[model samples]
Target: MVTAIVLAAGNSLRMGTQNKLLLPFAGTTVIAAVVEQIVKAGLQELIVVTGNEPDLVHQALIHLPVKLVHNAGYGTGMTGSIQTGIQSAKGNGYMICLGDMVLITAQQYESLNTTFEKAYHRDKTCICLPRFNGVKGNPVIFSSAYKNAILQHDDPEGCKAIIQANNPHIVWVEMDDDAVLRDMDYPEDYAALINL
Candidate 1:
C-alpha cells in the first residue's frame, strides 16, 4: 500500500489573498487536479494536509476519496504538514506531493510509483525521486524507514535535508516531462499555467 500525501497547508503569501490550491485549473481546482493524478496513479491511500483556509481546501476536495489532516503548525513550514500526513500513512512507503503542482499528470505519478516499487524490492531503504534533466522534482517517494527521521526533522528546509543527507539511498528516476518541476507560487505562475 503506497500512500500519497498532498501538502496543502501553506498560506500562499505570494498569491496575495487567494488560496492557490483552491484556484481553478484545467477545469478543476488546483488541489483537485493534483489529487486526481494521485488517484489515477493507483496509489492505495490518499491523505491531504490542509492549513491556512482548511475549510475552503476541504470544500475543493470534499468529493474525492481522501483523508483530511489539519496542521495547526502550518505557519511553521512544509515539514509540519508532512509530519501531520505521515502520522496516518499506512504504506511501507509514501509519496510527498505538492498541492500547487497541478500540472503533474497521472502518468508521471505512475512512473514514480513504478520506479519506487523496483527500488523497494531491491532495497527497502531506497528513496525514489523524479528528476528532469538532472533537476529533482515533486512527489518524491520515501520508504517508511525514514518516517521517524522525517518526524524528528526540525530544520525549516523540510525533507530536502533528509534526501541530501542520504544521497546514497536515492534512486533518481529520470523523466521526459517537465510538469514535475512546475508549481504555482504566485499569481503569475498560476496565470502561466492557465495559459499553457
Candidate 2:
C-alpha cells in the first residue's frame, strides 16, 4: 500500500487573506482538486494535514475518503505538516503532495507511482520525483526507509535536504507535462490557474 500525504496546512501568507487551498479551481476547491487527482490515480489511502484553517479544510474534504491530521506546529513550516502526515501513514511507501498544486493530474500521480513500484520491485531504497522539462515537481514518493529520516528532519528547507542527502537514491521520472511544475501560491498564480 502507498499513502498519499497531502500537505494543506500552510497559512497562505502569500495569498494575503485568502486560503489558497479553499479557493475554487476547476469547479472545486484547490485542495479537493489535488486530492481528487490522488484518488483518480487509484490511491486509496490519503492523509491530509491541516493547520491554518482546519475546520474549513476539513469541510472541504468532508465527503472524501481521507484522514485529516491537524498539525499544531504548522506555523513553523512545512516540515511539521510532513511529520504529522507521516505519523499517520500506514503504507510501504508514501507520496508527499501539496494541496495548492492544482494543476497536477491523476496520470502524473500514476506515473510517479509506477516509477516507485519499479524501484520497489528491485528492492531499492529510492525516492521517486517527477521532473517537468528540467525542473523537479511535486508529489515525491519515497520508500518507508526514509520515514524516520523525514520525521527527524528539522531544516527550514523542508524535505529537500533529505533528497539532497540521498541524491544517489533518487529516481527522477521525466514528465512531458508542465502542470507538474505549477502551484497556486500568489494571487497571480490563482489567476493563471483560472485562465488555464
Candidate 3:
C-alpha cells in the first residue's frame, strides 16, 4: 500500500488568485480533477494537505472520500506540508503529489508504479521520479529505505535538499507524457489547458 499525499496548501503568489487549486481546468477545478485522477489510479488512499483557505478546500473535496489535514505552518513553506504528509503516510512508500498538477494522468502514475514494483522486487531503493522531455515532475515515489532520509529533512527547502543529498539513490523513470510537466499557476496556463 503506497500513501498518496496531495499537497494543496500554498498561496498562489504568481497566479494572483485566491484559490489556484480550485481554479477550473476544462470544466472541473484542478484539485477536484487531479484528486479524481489519483483516486482512479488505485495507488492507495488519498490525503489532502490544506492551508491558507481550509474551509474552501474542504468544501471542494466534500464529495471525495479523502482525509484532509490542514498545515498551520504552510505559510512558512511547502516543507511543512511535505513533512506533515510524510509523517502521516502509511505503508512502505509514498507517492507525494501536488494539488496543482492537473495534467497528470493515470498512465503516468502507472509508469512510476511499475518502476517502484520493479525496484522493490529487486531489493533496490525505489525513488520513482517522472521525467518528461528531460524535465522532472512531481508525485515522486520515495521508497521505505529513504524514510529516515525524508523524515530527517529539516532545512525547510522542500525536496531539493533531499534530492540533491541523495542523488545516488534517485531512480529516474522516463515518461513521454507532457502533462507531467504542466502545472497551472497563472491565467495563461488555464487558458492553454482550455485551448487544448
Candidate 4:
C-alpha cells in the first residue's frame, strides 16, 4: 500500500505574512483542494502534516478522511515535516506531496502511484518521480526501504540528497502537464493560479 503524505507545514516566508496553503483556490482553500484531489485518486492512506496554523489547516480539511500530524519543528524547514510524516506513515511506500501545488490533477496523482506500484514490485527500493518534458517535479514517491535514509536526512533543502545518492533506484514517470512543477510561493504565483 502507498501512503500519501501531504506536507502543509510551510511558513509562507516568501508570501509575507500569509499562509499560501490556506489561501483561496478553486472555491475551496489551497490545501483542501490539493488534498481533495489525492483523496479522489484513491490512495491507500493519506497523512497531512500541519504547522504554522494547525487549527486553520485542520478546519480546512475537516471533511476529508485523512490523518493530520502536527510537526512542532516545522519552523525549521521542510525536512522536519518530511521526517514527521514519514514517522507516522504506515505503508510500504510513501508519496510526499506538497500542499501548495494545487494544480496537480487526480489523474496525475494516480499515474505516479501506478508507476510506483509497478516499479516497487520489481525493485522494493525504487523511487518514483514525475517529469514534465525533461524537468522533474514535486510529490515524489519512495519505497519504505528508504524510510531511515529520509529520517536521517540532514539537508534542510529536503530530499534531493537522497535522490542524488540513489540515482539507480529512480523511476522517472513523465507527466502530461507542468502542474507538478508549479507551486504557490508568492502573491504572483497565487494570482497565476487563479487566472488559470
Candidate 5:
C-alpha cells in the first residue's frame, strides 16, 4: 500500500491575510480540490497534516475518506508538519505532496505512480520525483529503506536535506504537467494557477 501524505498545515504568513487553502478555485476550496484529486487518483489511504485552521481543514475534509492529524508545532515551519504527516503514513511507501499544489490530474498522478513503480520493481530503494520542464516537482515517492533516515531528521524542512544528500538514489521522471510545480504561496499564486 502507498499512502499519500498531504501537508496542509502552516499559518500561511506569506499569503498576506487570506486562508489560501479555503479559497475557492473551480467551485471548491483549493485544499478540497487537491484531496479529491488524490481520491480520484485511487489513493484511498490519505493522511492530511493540518494546523492553523484545524477545524476548518477538518470540516473541509469531512466528506473525504481522509484521516486528519494535527501538527502541534506547525508554527515552527513546514518540516514539523511534514514529520507529523510522515509519522501518520500507514503504508510502507509514501507519496508525500503539498496541499497548496492544485491542478494535478489523475493522469499526472498515474505518471508519478508509474515512475516509482518502475524504480521499485528494480529492487532498489529509490525515490521517484517529478521533473517538470527540467525542474523538480512535488509528490516524491520514497521507498521504505529511508524510513530510519527520515525519522532522524530534526530539521524543520524534513526530507530536503536527505533528498539532497541522496540524490543518487532518486529517479527523476519527466512530466508535462506544470501543476506539479505550482504551489499557492500567495494570492498571486491563485491567479497564476488560474491563468495557466
Candidate 6:
C-alpha cells in the first residue's frame, strides 16, 4: 500500500499575497482538485500537510476523506512539511504530491501507483518519477526504504538532492501529457491553466 502525501504548506509568496491553492479551478479549489484526483485513484491512504492558511485549506478539503495535518514549521521550508507528512504516513511507499498541480489526472495517479507497486516488488528501494517529453515532473514516489533518508533530508528547497543521490534506484515512468510538468506558482500559470 502506498500513501499519497499532498504538500500544501507553501506561503505562495510568488503569487503575490494570493493562496494559489485556494484559487478556483475546475469548479473546485486547486488543492481540492489535486486531492480529488488522488482519492479517485484509490490509493491506500491520503495525508494533506497544511500551512499558510490552515483553516481555509481545511475548509476547502473538509468534505474529502483525507487526513489533514498542520505543519507548524512550514514557514521554515518545504522539508519540514515533508517531514510532517512522512511522520504520519504508514504505507510501504509514499507518493509526494504537490497540492497546486491540479492538472494531473486520476488516471495518471493510478498509473504511477501501479508502476510503484510493480517496481517495489522487484526492488524495495525503488523510486518512481514521471517524465514528459524527456522532462522530469512532480509527484514522485519513494519506497519506505528511503523513509529515513527523506526524514533526515536537510534541504529546505525540497527533495531534489535525495532524488539525485538515489538516481540508480529511480524508475523513470514516461507520461503521455505535460500536466506533470505544469505547476501553478504564479498568477499567469493559473491564468493559463484555468483558461485551458
For model 5, which pairs clash?
Answer: 79-156
RMSD of each: 0.9, 1.0, 1.6, 0.6, 1.4, 0.7
Runs of candidate 1 exceeding 4 Å displacement: none
lDDT of 1 by residue, 106-181 (tens): 8889988888888898888899989999888988999999999999999854788899898999999888988989
In candidate 1, where is summed lDDT lowest over 10 consecutive residues? 155-164
Model 5 Cα lDDT, one tens digit per residue, 60-116: 889999999998888887777767777877776788888888888877877787677
Give the range of the ten consecutive residues with the poorest summed lDDT in model 2. Answer: 154-163
Segments of candidate 3 deviating more than 4 angstroms: none
TM-scores vs. true structure, each candidate: 0.97, 0.97, 0.92, 0.99, 0.94, 0.98
Whole-structure CA lDDT of model 3? 0.80
- Residue 33, candidate 4: Cα error in Å is 0.4
Model 2 lDDT at residue 154:
82
Clashing residue pairs in all predictions, respectively, total 0, 0, 0, 0, 1, 0
Name the runs in model 2 displaced over 4 angstroms.
Answer: none
* Per-residue lDDT over 10-121 for candidate 3, one digit per residue giving the tens place of the 0 to 100 score: 9878878557888767577888889888887877678899997888888888998788988998988877887788777775677888888888887777677778777777
Give a tens-digit lDDT track for model 4, residues 1-196. Answer: 8999999998999998988898888899999999999999999799999989999999999999999999998988999999999999999898999999999999999999999999988999999999999999988999999999999999876999899899999999999899999988889999999998
lDDT (Cα, 0-100) at 108 in candidate 4: 95
Task: Give the distance in Å from residue 69's predicted Cα in candidate 6 to where it truly belongs.
Answer: 0.8
- Where is the poorest 10-residue window by lDDT in model 4? 155-164
Worst 10 residues of 5 by lDDT: 115-124
Candidate 2, residues 1-196: lDDT per residue as tens digits? Answer: 7899999999999999999999988888999989998999988789999999999999999888999999998999988998899999998888999998888889989888888988887765788989987899887998988999998988844798888888988899998888888987889999988997
